[model samples]
Target: MFQEKNRHLPCFAHTLDLTASDNENMKPLIEKVKKTITYFKQSVNAADELRRVQPEDKTLKLKQSLPTRWNSVFYMLERFLMLNKYVASIILSDSKAPEIMTASELEEIKEFIQILKPIESVSKELSGEKYIYHIK
Candidate 1:
């Protein structure tokens, strides 16, 4: 029999979570994006304005990231990028809307999403597993 103390195992999902969460360089950008999303989410008029401006073919709404939820930031960013055009229009026309993300920030967000996609996929797969086998 093997002693539990002699072997070490790490949680892949947890590792991924840490990697995603340890983004000090992106905190400011992320915060700005979060605030923008929060504005839309909390204001019925803003949400309605977004809906009205959005294309008929696209129905997805902005997503807010929760601290407790895994990969929420990624999802939020992904959705934000998806609706970037509509969001920009709203920000430009609405006096109450938060300032729109700069072109550099938007580009950085696209790069960030590219980097996180694979990690997110792996995390999802690891988390979705129903069982794990332990060697005896």
Candidate 2:
């Protein structure tokens, strides 16, 4: 028999991804947030301009989600929420801001972040080399 450490269990990250994707409410909001990221990435000039316009904090920068990586969506939303004020400023100045989310949509994003936080923490735990909950 192989060593105990040689065997790998089911991937928690993949399970989390599937579970989140299966949620009907999250589907549309994830797409909307992805679209917002795409809008900012579509033009280097506009993205650079936004960087200049926002504060020096790195968390204020927008992040795009990858199609295959579930955690990226969480990071994207987290950063987007962090940078909302600067994002609003950019939207006010740039005609290419794509579509602005309504107040309700913003509230939805906030809710989504709350929903994802636990999974995000679990994913982080599973990714570490040390014992789970090491940082906690």
Candidate 3:
């Protein structure tokens, strides 16, 4: 549809983003993470339970990824991995916790994070004000 109106659209980046999001290997894990985040955020008692499981040193709350922002997923997963143990405890302790990820799923998330790290860095670089090419 977009091509039908104006074919000049530079959709390479958008294509990449879509590929990453819809990849067969990642779809399930991403959905699970999204569901988990949503469940906690929607319920006050669940959020409180998650906080209780975390150690005193970590005070950050779980964050959900914005549907429109690709990097937000990385940020969300990064924090989620950091609080993995606490999250697991919350799942075990609360009967209402969203579907728990398996050990393999946790490992896969870590791998996905690593895959996205360089892309995230590139995204930051592209958004910076510094000149891409200083014609000296």
Q: Which candidate gets the maximum lDDT versus the true structure?
A: 1
Each candidate: how many clashes?
A: 0, 0, 0
| Deviation of model 2 at 102, angstroms | 1.3
Residue 55, model 2: Cα distance from true site in angstroms: 1.9
Task: Give the TM-score of each candidate.
Answer: 0.86, 0.76, 0.78
Model 2 residue-pair collision total = 0
Ranking by lDDT: 1, 3, 2
**Candidate 2: minimum summed lDDT over ten consecutive residues — where?**
127-136
Model 3, which residues run further than 4 Å from truth?
A: 1-19, 130-136
Clashing pairs for model 3 are none
lDDT (Cα, tens digit) per residue for candidate 2, span 1-136: 3378768555666677667645787778778777877777887876787788765765356888786776777888888888777667777777867677778888888898898889888776665535533232
Runs in model 2 with CA error above 4 Å? Answer: 1-9, 57-60, 129-136
lDDT of 3 at 47: 84
Number of the candidate with higher lDDT, 1 or 3? 1
lDDT of each: 0.86, 0.74, 0.76
**Residue 52, model 3: Cα distance from true site in angstroms:** 2.9
- What's the distance in Å from true for residue 67, model 3? 2.0
Off by over 4 Å in 1: 1-10, 133-136
Query: For residues 1-136, could you state the per-residue lDDT of candidate 1 as single tens digits?
Result: 4377778577778679669856998889999999999888988887898898877786779999888777888999999999988888888888888889999999999999898898888888888888886757
